[model samples]
Target: MPPQTREVVVQKNVPATMRDGTTLFSNVYRPAEGGPYPVLLTRLPYGKDIPSYTTFLDPVRADGSGYIVVVQDVRGRFASGGEFEPFASEYEDGHDTVEWAARLPGADGRVGMFGLSYYGKTQWQAAVTKPPSLLSMVPGITWGNHLNGAQMRGGAYELGTIYSWAVTTIAPDILFRRYRDDPQQLGRKLPELVAAIDTLQAGGGYDVLPLTKLPDPDGLTPFVREGFERGVDDGWWEQLNIDGRYGNVSAVTLHIGGWYDIFLGETLRQYAAMKEVAERRGTAPPRLLVGPWTHGNFGSTLGELDFGIGSSGILLNYRGDLADYHLRFFDATLKGREEALADRPPVEVFVMGENRWRGYEEWPPPGAREEVWHLSGGGSLTREAPSGEPDAYDYDPKDPVPTLGGSILMPQIYRAGARDQSPNEERPDVLCYTSRPLEHDYTVLGPVWVRLFAASSAPDTDFVARLVDVHPDGRAIGIADGIIRASARESYPEPGVISPTAPSPIKPGEVYEYRIDLWATGNTFRAGHRIRLEVTSSSFPRWDRNLNTGESGARSSRTEVAHQRIFHDPDHPSSLTLTTVEG
Candidate 1:
């Protein structure tokens, strides 16, 4: 038998108190050996299936990785006694849970937390409180942005993902029409979503959204009704930034986020905020590992089988490669392990197109300078703008540009290869900009931003940019992309209206500068690889439909068609600015 093997022992039904007299349930997982060890706890919205653990990060590994494990249900979840309100009592409940777990029979008094997603949120909550016994955390693929930005991007609420999770997983499928009052009140506003969640406390004891529109409640899942009514970006999202309040948490964190994850921004934010706290407290910030992946599974290939040649050199698991390294970190911090004491660089990111890992001293690197590639005729992108013969494309919001190339969720089988984009350029609505087949590898990192000058025949429109790699053989695989509504040109905060009182049809010759963020990417423009930029006006379903009327955009059930033109000359300087590595 292995000397470090832990005996299966659990103290069930243990209770910890929240400030409001609410109680949280925790089940402790500890070593059979009677020696003291540092405590590791995770408080989550998920049930602590004492029979089957909910977390993927191994606590037994923490035995070899050297720590005690405790998994607990957050307030109002499982056996815990209280009403479950998103982010409302997580901070207070986590503080109590961690402090209590640290005093378990063989606890060393120092505590750490581990988990992902909602579990990860609990860690941030525990750390933010600067709990007396809490020491460190390994939060993976989680977000503090509970609504608006986290679940929905650009006000596009994720009706399918959220509703599916609630109805299918929460409880026995049942009818709960009590929440049908949301749609009218919220109209997709933040406060309304919270009220919707509050509506769950009604007589039937079901969660509901604020003024949520449950057009088909009779057929809809319970989660759907609750999510719709609650789909706003109100202060309910403050939990996403609890790390900002961590002057009390000097724990060394080890941050992890996947390249294809929806929570990439939060992972980055947590690391940055933790680093600030550690600097002032004379400790180092948490180490970070961003892998080329979608969602949680890391340190492994995407699916069941490898794609052969394309997936040559990659770390299948960040945990195996980095855990021992991190253990050395905790050894240095918690046990004075000398080998763990060393200074490392600031950041690491998974470069997508390149399919490799790279490091940097800071994020949004200061070295980020722009290299503009102008759009030329005949689907060409060159340093030189097309003269006399400018390429033209017409955009109709009715049949807007389809979705392609970006950090999104879908099976890998359906994702098109970089050159797959070649066919999309065939459409009249998409403007193609391609550089001649690359003479050598052109790798780019950092956020890809595009600046375009355009005008529409209608008051409102959209500008979508797709970054692609067109292979010499005509394979246009998507890399990354972004979308911006024309009416909200001035700010995301204000989705403005054009000709609000009097509808003025925009003249074709009118010019407007549109800045669109293509998010981030790590790709190499291989020799013979033609770098392409496909510009269109919509990414349907992914982005809410744009009501081309401009003034009543996105809100009104009605939509109008708009004609858009792209200009690329001295008169209209349209260009794409990308961050390229020295390679």
Candidate 2:
């Protein structure tokens, strides 16, 4: 049984000063009867009082559990004071806030942090500062670098997610300030502004030729235009990148990721990096928990499928609910309780298909082997490479492939997670290569990628690959998918480069080896399930359409159709690399 806690005290609009004299506001939730309790700090641009469905950390509940919870509004939002430059100023602001939280009236010296998405990023920013009071952190569904996860991905702008975010989320913050003096007027205007943005988004305005002309001419969100203009990954990206700052984090880190989350790859990368950091310093490796969830929806149902009751974070039998799991982790890390630390595995993963939670010592669980399945003629995916002429498809930029379901972060309009891909797969632009039914249970546990030796009629184009699990009823549920702009090939330096946004045009009608990162997944393909691979040049509205005529870097609405070729002969062996887990 849990210990009886004291009455909760909720303080509103508490101030914490940064080094630059900017004051950030936080709501402090503390036990009214406790002497001093450990601190859990969550700093985010979202209002401190508002509950985030993603993180789902209730400060009131944490306070009742005998901890002082500090939920703060970061600089330039709500009660905080400063110019709102996203990703910038977080390190310093988070550092100052942590130090301040440590000395609060009912706070112990130790401080831990937990939140999802941007809130999770604040924890990393604070950890990088190496604040003396910082002890542990649980950063969920966030990224190691902004370019890879937040802004752009695989040399393409995250049009749907970022643009919608600018219009819906950030634009409202700006509106709040514009009408703060007249709350009544602001209240009426906010809904109208949202409705306007919604109309634009749902009316196929996102498919407009030039992406630069987005957020409409009325200035809903100018930031969206800034993202389109800065195609090259240059100095602006360097300022927000926290790749080299991992070593500075002294806190024991726990990373939480969703298989279908937009930042899945980035989340895994950070976990591996921090685990290596701990090994180098002779400390315990970090923990990782990956669910079969979307960005924030940690429920049993995702898209058209349900993984039963055990799938939801709210029903995890291992450690009560998600909140209880967090509390136990904090208690063990912050207070160093022996009983709380007992028998906890370093890694926990929810394997789809089989729909079961499994524990492991590390990610990519040891003994996972790379199994290569070759793409062949007659729209077949098999182990043998067939000698045949390449498959051809006409890719028109105007009528590119549509996004069915997978990992995407558009406004509420775009659905994510596993969904039937029949609608999109039926398109002529999407070339389907399906495999025979599996003879035995096959489990893929790590990164998935496809190597294609293909030629294009244009100087630049795009190659999109998707892995689907075909059910007996012909439902092609998308498991993983990725895209690569032909121009950004090999642009990254050895051992590093955040998704390489620089354009390096390819010669027309030239065959080049393109590796499409399909990201990571943990799924057991039971016997009789067929594996399907769809090759396409676009996944519309999810990614900006890649105009085949290579001049996308400049402001040109001109587009050209390209003849795409996929080779699967012995000389040019196109294959899918699946990290198959051993039974």
lDDT top scorer: 2
For model 1, residues 185-221, the per-residue Cα lDDT tens digits are: 3243434333433433221112122214432323334
In model 1, the runs with Cα more than 4 Å from the true position are 1-5, 50-56, 145-149, 154-249, 276-282, 299-333, 336-338, 341-346, 352-354, 359-369, 385-405, 410-425, 487-510, 550-555
Which structure among the candidates has the greatest TM-score? 2
Lowest lDDT block of 10, candidate 2 = 491-500
Position 371, candidate 2: lDDT: 88
How accurate locally is residue 469 in candidate 1, as Cα lDDT from 0 to 100? 72
Measured on C-alpha atoms, candidate 1 has an lDDT of 0.60
Per-candidate local distance difference test: 0.60, 0.82
